[model samples]
Target: MFLYTENFEGQKEMAMAGLSRALAEDRVDRDIIPLLEKINALDNYFTTSSCSGRISVMEMPHFGDKLNSVWLGKWHREVFIEEVFEAIGRHRSGQLWFLVRSPILHVAARTMDDAVKLLNLSIGLGFKYSSIKSVSHRKLLVEIRSTERMDVPLGEDGELWVSEEYIGRIVNLANAQVRRFKGKLKRLEDEIEVLEK
Candidate 1:
Protein backbone atom coordinates (compact mmCIF):
# COMPACT_ATOMS: atom_id res chain seq x y z
CA MET A 1 0.00 0.00 0.00
CA PHE A 2 1.08 3.57 -0.66
CA LEU A 3 0.97 6.22 2.02
CA TYR A 4 0.37 9.95 1.65
CA THR A 5 1.95 12.55 3.86
CA GLU A 6 1.55 16.32 4.41
CA ASN A 7 3.78 19.08 5.71
CA PHE A 8 1.63 20.66 8.42
CA GLU A 9 4.43 22.97 9.55
CA GLY A 10 4.72 24.66 6.14
CA GLN A 11 0.96 25.00 5.89
CA LYS A 12 0.76 26.53 9.36
CA GLU A 13 3.32 29.19 8.50
CA MET A 14 1.45 30.16 5.33
CA ALA A 15 -1.91 30.22 7.07
CA MET A 16 -0.56 32.31 9.94
CA ALA A 17 0.82 34.88 7.51
CA GLY A 18 -2.45 35.01 5.56
CA LEU A 19 -4.44 35.50 8.77
CA SER A 20 -2.18 38.28 9.88
CA ARG A 21 -2.64 40.12 6.59
CA ALA A 22 -6.38 39.68 6.65
CA LEU A 23 -6.57 41.03 10.18
CA ALA A 24 -4.35 44.00 9.36
CA GLU A 25 -6.51 44.83 6.35
CA ASP A 26 -9.65 44.65 8.50
CA ARG A 27 -11.08 42.05 6.17
CA VAL A 28 -12.63 39.86 8.83
CA ASP A 29 -16.28 40.49 9.56
CA ARG A 30 -16.77 42.55 12.69
CA ASP A 31 -19.52 40.45 14.24
CA ILE A 32 -17.57 37.21 13.98
CA ILE A 33 -14.27 38.60 15.33
CA PRO A 34 -14.73 37.27 18.83
CA LEU A 35 -15.42 33.77 17.60
CA LEU A 36 -12.44 33.97 15.27
CA GLU A 37 -10.24 34.98 18.15
CA LYS A 38 -11.43 32.10 20.26
CA ILE A 39 -10.81 29.61 17.48
CA ASN A 40 -7.37 30.96 16.66
CA ALA A 41 -6.44 30.75 20.32
CA LEU A 42 -6.57 26.98 19.89
CA ASP A 43 -3.30 25.39 18.83
CA ASN A 44 -4.48 23.11 16.05
CA TYR A 45 -6.75 25.34 13.97
CA PHE A 46 -7.06 28.63 12.08
CA THR A 47 -9.70 30.41 10.02
CA THR A 48 -9.61 31.09 6.29
CA SER A 49 -12.92 32.91 5.89
CA SER A 50 -16.28 33.35 7.56
CA CYS A 51 -19.60 35.12 7.56
CA SER A 52 -21.76 35.24 10.69
CA GLY A 53 -24.90 35.02 8.49
CA ARG A 54 -27.15 37.76 7.19
CA ILE A 55 -30.52 38.93 5.85
CA SER A 56 -30.41 41.34 2.93
CA VAL A 57 -32.40 43.14 0.28
CA MET A 58 -30.41 43.57 -2.90
CA GLU A 59 -30.93 45.42 -6.17
CA MET A 60 -29.17 44.17 -9.25
CA PRO A 61 -29.22 44.73 -12.98
CA HIS A 62 -29.63 41.00 -13.47
CA PHE A 63 -29.02 37.71 -11.76
CA GLY A 64 -25.41 36.99 -10.67
CA ASP A 65 -24.17 40.39 -11.79
CA LYS A 66 -22.34 41.17 -8.60
CA LEU A 67 -20.22 43.96 -10.02
CA ASN A 68 -23.26 46.18 -10.40
CA SER A 69 -25.37 44.81 -7.63
CA VAL A 70 -26.30 47.19 -4.85
CA TRP A 71 -27.38 46.30 -1.38
CA LEU A 72 -30.50 48.36 -0.89
CA GLY A 73 -30.52 47.12 2.67
CA LYS A 74 -28.41 44.57 4.52
CA TRP A 75 -28.44 43.39 8.10
CA HIS A 76 -26.22 40.86 9.81
CA ARG A 77 -28.97 40.26 12.35
CA GLU A 78 -32.74 39.85 12.10
CA VAL A 79 -34.55 42.49 10.03
CA PHE A 80 -37.82 44.30 10.49
CA ILE A 81 -40.56 44.40 7.85
CA GLU A 82 -40.41 48.18 7.70
CA GLU A 83 -36.75 47.93 6.85
CA VAL A 84 -37.58 45.73 3.90
CA PHE A 85 -40.12 48.28 2.74
CA GLU A 86 -37.53 51.02 2.95
CA ALA A 87 -35.10 49.01 0.91
CA ILE A 88 -37.74 48.20 -1.69
CA GLY A 89 -38.45 51.90 -2.10
CA ARG A 90 -34.83 52.46 -3.10
CA HIS A 91 -34.91 50.14 -6.08
CA ARG A 92 -34.74 52.34 -9.20
CA SER A 93 -33.77 49.87 -11.90
CA GLY A 94 -33.29 46.13 -12.22
CA GLN A 95 -34.41 43.20 -10.02
CA LEU A 96 -35.03 43.25 -6.30
CA TRP A 97 -34.56 40.27 -4.02
CA PHE A 98 -35.12 39.51 -0.37
CA LEU A 99 -32.64 36.96 0.89
CA VAL A 100 -31.78 35.06 4.06
CA ARG A 101 -28.42 33.34 4.26
CA SER A 102 -27.09 30.83 6.75
CA PRO A 103 -23.95 31.39 8.75
CA ILE A 104 -20.72 30.02 7.27
CA LEU A 105 -17.24 29.61 8.69
CA HIS A 106 -14.25 28.10 6.91
CA VAL A 107 -11.73 26.72 9.35
CA ALA A 108 -8.42 25.05 8.56
CA ALA A 109 -7.33 22.34 10.95
CA ARG A 110 -3.78 21.21 11.61
CA THR A 111 -4.56 17.62 10.73
CA MET A 112 -7.25 15.40 9.26
CA ASP A 113 -8.27 14.31 12.74
CA ASP A 114 -8.70 17.90 13.84
CA ALA A 115 -10.74 18.69 10.75
CA VAL A 116 -13.03 15.73 11.36
CA LYS A 117 -13.52 16.70 14.97
CA LEU A 118 -14.53 20.24 14.05
CA LEU A 119 -16.83 18.97 11.29
CA ASN A 120 -18.60 16.56 13.60
CA LEU A 121 -18.99 19.12 16.33
CA SER A 122 -20.42 21.69 13.91
CA ILE A 123 -22.89 19.20 12.49
CA GLY A 124 -24.00 18.19 15.97
CA LEU A 125 -24.58 21.83 16.89
CA GLY A 126 -27.33 22.23 14.23
CA PHE A 127 -24.98 23.15 11.41
CA LYS A 128 -26.50 20.41 9.29
CA TYR A 129 -24.73 21.59 6.13
CA SER A 130 -21.30 21.40 7.71
CA SER A 131 -18.65 19.37 5.94
CA ILE A 132 -14.99 18.94 5.23
CA LYS A 133 -14.75 21.25 2.24
CA SER A 134 -11.28 20.41 1.09
CA VAL A 135 -8.29 18.24 1.97
CA SER A 136 -4.80 18.31 0.56
CA HIS A 137 -1.18 18.39 1.62
CA ARG A 138 -1.45 22.13 2.09
CA LYS A 139 -4.63 22.30 4.15
CA LEU A 140 -7.57 20.45 5.64
CA LEU A 141 -10.56 22.77 5.58
CA VAL A 142 -13.90 22.33 7.35
CA GLU A 143 -16.89 24.37 6.34
CA ILE A 144 -19.44 25.05 9.06
CA ARG A 145 -22.87 25.92 7.70
CA SER A 146 -26.62 25.76 8.30
CA THR A 147 -29.78 25.10 6.27
CA GLU A 148 -31.60 28.40 6.62
CA ARG A 149 -31.95 30.32 3.37
CA MET A 150 -34.37 32.34 1.23
CA ASP A 151 -34.24 33.98 -2.22
CA VAL A 152 -37.45 35.66 -3.19
CA PRO A 153 -38.02 38.13 -5.98
CA LEU A 154 -40.10 41.07 -4.92
CA GLY A 155 -39.96 43.27 -8.03
CA GLU A 156 -38.11 44.44 -11.15
CA ASP A 157 -37.50 47.67 -13.10
CA GLY A 158 -38.88 50.03 -10.47
CA GLU A 159 -42.09 48.05 -10.03
CA LEU A 160 -43.63 45.87 -7.38
CA TRP A 161 -44.58 42.33 -8.36
CA VAL A 162 -46.09 41.42 -4.99
CA SER A 163 -48.46 43.20 -2.70
CA GLU A 164 -47.23 44.84 0.50
CA GLU A 165 -48.97 42.07 2.41
CA TYR A 166 -46.97 39.44 0.53
CA ILE A 167 -43.74 41.32 1.18
CA GLY A 168 -44.60 41.38 4.86
CA ARG A 169 -45.16 37.63 4.86
CA ILE A 170 -41.81 37.03 3.18
CA VAL A 171 -40.08 39.34 5.62
CA ASN A 172 -41.49 37.32 8.52
CA LEU A 173 -40.28 34.10 6.93
CA ALA A 174 -36.78 35.50 6.36
CA ASN A 175 -36.66 36.71 9.95
CA ALA A 176 -37.51 33.26 11.20
CA GLN A 177 -34.67 31.82 9.19
CA VAL A 178 -32.32 34.49 10.49
CA ARG A 179 -33.23 33.67 14.07
CA ARG A 180 -32.71 29.97 13.45
CA PHE A 181 -29.23 30.40 11.97
CA LYS A 182 -28.17 32.90 14.62
CA GLY A 183 -28.92 30.31 17.27
CA LYS A 184 -26.78 27.79 15.43
CA LEU A 185 -23.92 30.32 15.22
CA LYS A 186 -24.17 30.97 18.95
CA ARG A 187 -24.11 27.28 19.74
CA LEU A 188 -21.09 26.77 17.52
CA GLU A 189 -19.32 29.68 19.14
CA ASP A 190 -20.02 28.27 22.60
CA GLU A 191 -18.93 24.74 21.70
CA ILE A 192 -15.95 25.56 19.51
CA GLU A 193 -13.74 25.43 22.59
CA VAL A 194 -14.09 21.66 22.53
CA LEU A 195 -11.42 21.54 19.82
CA GLU A 196 -8.81 22.49 22.45
CA LYS A 197 -9.49 19.34 24.49
Candidate 2:
Protein backbone atom coordinates (compact mmCIF):
# COMPACT_ATOMS: atom_id res chain seq x y z
CA MET A 1 0.00 0.00 0.00
CA PHE A 2 1.14 3.51 -0.79
CA LEU A 3 1.29 6.06 1.98
CA TYR A 4 -0.47 9.35 1.26
CA THR A 5 0.55 12.39 3.16
CA GLU A 6 -1.17 15.72 2.75
CA ASN A 7 0.29 19.01 3.79
CA PHE A 8 -2.36 21.64 4.51
CA GLU A 9 -0.12 24.49 5.59
CA GLY A 10 -0.39 26.56 2.41
CA GLN A 11 -4.15 26.15 1.97
CA LYS A 12 -4.82 26.74 5.66
CA GLU A 13 -2.91 30.01 5.54
CA MET A 14 -4.78 31.15 2.45
CA ALA A 15 -8.13 30.20 3.93
CA MET A 16 -7.39 32.12 7.11
CA ALA A 17 -6.39 35.22 5.19
CA GLY A 18 -9.51 35.07 3.10
CA LEU A 19 -11.64 34.55 6.19
CA SER A 20 -10.07 37.63 7.74
CA ARG A 21 -10.92 39.72 4.70
CA ALA A 22 -14.47 38.43 4.59
CA LEU A 23 -14.91 39.15 8.29
CA ALA A 24 -13.47 42.65 7.99
CA GLU A 25 -15.70 43.46 5.03
CA ASP A 26 -18.77 42.04 6.75
CA ARG A 27 -19.22 39.79 3.76
CA VAL A 28 -20.10 36.66 5.72
CA ASP A 29 -23.74 36.10 6.59
CA ARG A 30 -24.42 36.97 10.22
CA ASP A 31 -26.33 33.82 11.16
CA ILE A 32 -23.68 31.43 9.85
CA ILE A 33 -20.60 33.26 11.01
CA PRO A 34 -20.39 31.31 14.22
CA LEU A 35 -20.42 28.07 12.29
CA LEU A 36 -17.78 29.32 9.93
CA GLU A 37 -15.62 30.32 12.81
CA LYS A 38 -16.07 27.00 14.51
CA ILE A 39 -15.09 25.07 11.42
CA ASN A 40 -12.12 27.29 10.76
CA ALA A 41 -10.98 26.92 14.32
CA LEU A 42 -10.37 23.30 13.55
CA ASP A 43 -6.96 22.65 12.07
CA ASN A 44 -8.25 20.33 9.35
CA TYR A 45 -11.07 22.36 7.83
CA PHE A 46 -12.14 25.69 6.37
CA THR A 47 -15.17 26.97 4.52
CA THR A 48 -15.00 28.21 0.98
CA SER A 49 -18.64 29.16 0.51
CA SER A 50 -22.00 28.89 2.23
CA CYS A 51 -25.59 30.07 2.11
CA SER A 52 -28.03 29.59 4.96
CA GLY A 53 -30.81 29.30 2.37
CA ARG A 54 -33.41 31.69 0.99
CA ILE A 55 -36.72 32.27 -0.68
CA SER A 56 -37.07 34.86 -3.39
CA VAL A 57 -39.08 36.30 -6.26
CA MET A 58 -37.04 37.14 -9.31
CA GLU A 59 -37.54 38.40 -12.84
CA MET A 60 -35.38 37.21 -15.65
CA PRO A 61 -35.43 37.55 -19.42
CA HIS A 62 -35.46 33.80 -19.80
CA PHE A 63 -34.93 30.65 -17.86
CA GLY A 64 -31.31 29.98 -16.72
CA ASP A 65 -30.39 33.59 -17.53
CA LYS A 66 -29.14 34.52 -14.11
CA LEU A 67 -26.96 37.28 -15.45
CA ASN A 68 -30.07 39.32 -16.15
CA SER A 69 -32.11 38.13 -13.20
CA VAL A 70 -33.54 40.85 -11.03
CA TRP A 71 -34.57 40.12 -7.48
CA LEU A 72 -37.89 41.64 -6.50
CA GLY A 73 -37.63 40.27 -2.99
CA LYS A 74 -35.57 37.80 -1.03
CA TRP A 75 -35.73 36.53 2.53
CA HIS A 76 -33.42 34.34 4.54
CA ARG A 77 -36.31 33.07 6.62
CA GLU A 78 -39.90 32.14 5.92
CA VAL A 79 -41.90 34.90 4.28
CA PHE A 80 -45.54 35.94 4.34
CA ILE A 81 -47.81 35.80 1.30
CA GLU A 82 -48.28 39.56 1.36
CA GLU A 83 -44.55 40.09 1.06
CA VAL A 84 -44.29 37.91 -2.05
CA PHE A 85 -47.31 39.63 -3.59
CA GLU A 86 -45.68 43.00 -3.12
CA ALA A 87 -42.69 41.68 -5.04
CA ILE A 88 -44.80 40.21 -7.82
CA GLY A 89 -46.40 43.59 -8.31
CA ARG A 90 -43.01 44.91 -9.43
CA HIS A 91 -42.60 42.37 -12.19
CA ARG A 92 -42.28 43.93 -15.62
CA SER A 93 -40.85 42.34 -18.78
CA GLY A 94 -39.51 38.98 -17.85
CA GLN A 95 -40.27 35.57 -16.47
CA LEU A 96 -41.16 35.82 -12.82
CA TRP A 97 -40.00 32.96 -10.64
CA PHE A 98 -40.55 32.12 -7.01
CA LEU A 99 -37.63 30.14 -5.76
CA VAL A 100 -36.77 28.27 -2.57
CA ARG A 101 -33.25 27.04 -2.04
CA SER A 102 -31.86 24.91 0.73
CA PRO A 103 -28.80 25.69 2.75
CA ILE A 104 -25.48 25.03 0.98
CA LEU A 105 -22.00 24.86 2.36
CA HIS A 106 -18.65 24.18 0.67
CA VAL A 107 -15.99 23.01 3.06
CA ALA A 108 -12.32 22.41 2.40
CA ALA A 109 -10.61 19.64 4.27
CA ARG A 110 -6.97 18.86 4.80
CA THR A 111 -7.27 15.27 3.71
CA MET A 112 -9.66 12.84 2.11
CA ASP A 113 -10.48 11.44 5.52
CA ASP A 114 -11.27 14.88 6.81
CA ALA A 115 -13.54 15.56 3.83
CA VAL A 116 -15.36 12.28 4.35
CA LYS A 117 -15.90 12.98 8.03
CA LEU A 118 -17.56 16.29 7.32
CA LEU A 119 -19.60 14.85 4.47
CA ASN A 120 -21.03 12.11 6.65
CA LEU A 121 -21.77 14.54 9.44
CA SER A 122 -23.67 16.82 7.09
CA ILE A 123 -25.75 13.96 5.69
CA GLY A 124 -26.54 12.73 9.17
CA LEU A 125 -27.68 16.23 10.07
CA GLY A 126 -30.26 16.20 7.23
CA PHE A 127 -28.15 17.61 4.45
CA LYS A 128 -29.13 14.69 2.29
CA TYR A 129 -27.18 15.89 -0.72
CA SER A 130 -23.89 16.05 1.09
CA SER A 131 -20.99 14.68 -0.93
CA ILE A 132 -17.38 15.02 -1.75
CA LYS A 133 -17.48 17.65 -4.45
CA SER A 134 -13.87 17.53 -5.57
CA VAL A 135 -10.50 16.09 -4.75
CA SER A 136 -7.06 17.04 -5.94
CA HIS A 137 -3.57 17.68 -4.70
CA ARG A 138 -4.56 21.22 -3.88
CA LYS A 139 -7.89 20.58 -2.25
CA LEU A 140 -10.47 18.17 -0.91
CA LEU A 141 -13.92 19.71 -0.92
CA VAL A 142 -17.09 18.47 0.74
CA GLU A 143 -20.36 20.03 -0.33
CA ILE A 144 -23.04 20.10 2.33
CA ARG A 145 -26.48 20.52 0.82
CA SER A 146 -30.13 19.62 1.26
CA THR A 147 -32.99 18.62 -1.04
CA GLU A 148 -35.34 21.49 -0.20
CA ARG A 149 -35.81 23.51 -3.35
CA MET A 150 -38.47 24.98 -5.60
CA ASP A 151 -38.38 26.85 -8.89
CA VAL A 152 -42.00 27.66 -9.55
CA PRO A 153 -42.81 29.87 -12.48
CA LEU A 154 -45.12 32.58 -11.26
CA GLY A 155 -45.55 34.55 -14.48
CA GLU A 156 -44.06 35.82 -17.70
CA ASP A 157 -43.96 39.19 -19.43
CA GLY A 158 -45.63 40.95 -16.49
CA GLU A 159 -48.60 38.56 -16.37
CA LEU A 160 -49.62 36.14 -13.66
CA TRP A 161 -49.88 32.50 -14.54
CA VAL A 162 -51.59 31.57 -11.28
CA SER A 163 -54.14 33.35 -9.17
CA GLU A 164 -53.33 35.16 -5.90
CA GLU A 165 -54.87 32.28 -3.99
CA TYR A 166 -52.54 29.87 -5.73
CA ILE A 167 -49.61 32.05 -4.77
CA GLY A 168 -50.70 31.85 -1.16
CA ARG A 169 -50.72 28.07 -1.28
CA ILE A 170 -47.22 27.86 -2.75
CA VAL A 171 -45.95 30.39 -0.25
CA ASN A 172 -47.10 28.18 2.58
CA LEU A 173 -45.30 25.20 1.12
CA ALA A 174 -42.14 27.18 0.51
CA ASN A 175 -42.13 28.57 4.02
CA ALA A 176 -42.45 25.09 5.41
CA GLN A 177 -39.46 23.97 3.39
CA VAL A 178 -37.52 27.01 4.60
CA ARG A 179 -38.22 26.16 8.21
CA ARG A 180 -37.16 22.58 7.69
CA PHE A 181 -33.83 23.43 6.10
CA LYS A 182 -33.02 26.18 8.58
CA GLY A 183 -33.41 23.67 11.34
CA LYS A 184 -31.05 21.33 9.55
CA LEU A 185 -28.50 24.11 9.24
CA LYS A 186 -28.73 24.82 12.93
CA ARG A 187 -28.24 21.18 13.80
CA LEU A 188 -25.19 20.95 11.60
CA GLU A 189 -23.78 24.05 13.21
CA ASP A 190 -24.32 22.62 16.64
CA GLU A 191 -22.72 19.29 15.79
CA ILE A 192 -19.76 20.32 13.60
CA GLU A 193 -17.41 20.30 16.53
CA VAL A 194 -17.84 16.57 16.69
CA LEU A 195 -15.29 16.30 13.91
CA GLU A 196 -12.66 17.64 16.23
CA LYS A 197 -13.34 15.07 18.91
Q: Write the per-residue lDDT of candidate 2 for residues 1-197, one digit (tens) a residue.
A: 11112567777777789978988998777787888888988988988888889999999999999998999999988898889999999999889999999988888887777888898898888899889888787678889999999999998999899999999999999999988998888887789899988
- Candidate 1 residue pairs that clash: none
Q: Which candidate is the best by lDDT?
A: 2
Distance from true location, Cα of 73 in model 2, Å? 1.1
Question: Could you tell me the lDDT of residue 81 within candidate 2?
Answer: 89
Pick out the ten consecutive residues of candidate 2 with the lowest summed lDDT. Answer: 1-10
Model 2 spans with C-alpha error above 4 angstroms: 1-7
TM-score of each: 0.88, 0.93
* Backbone atom clashes (below 3 Å) for every candidate: 0, 0
lDDT score for residue 174 of model 2: 95
List per-candidate RMSD values in Å. Answer: 2.5, 1.9
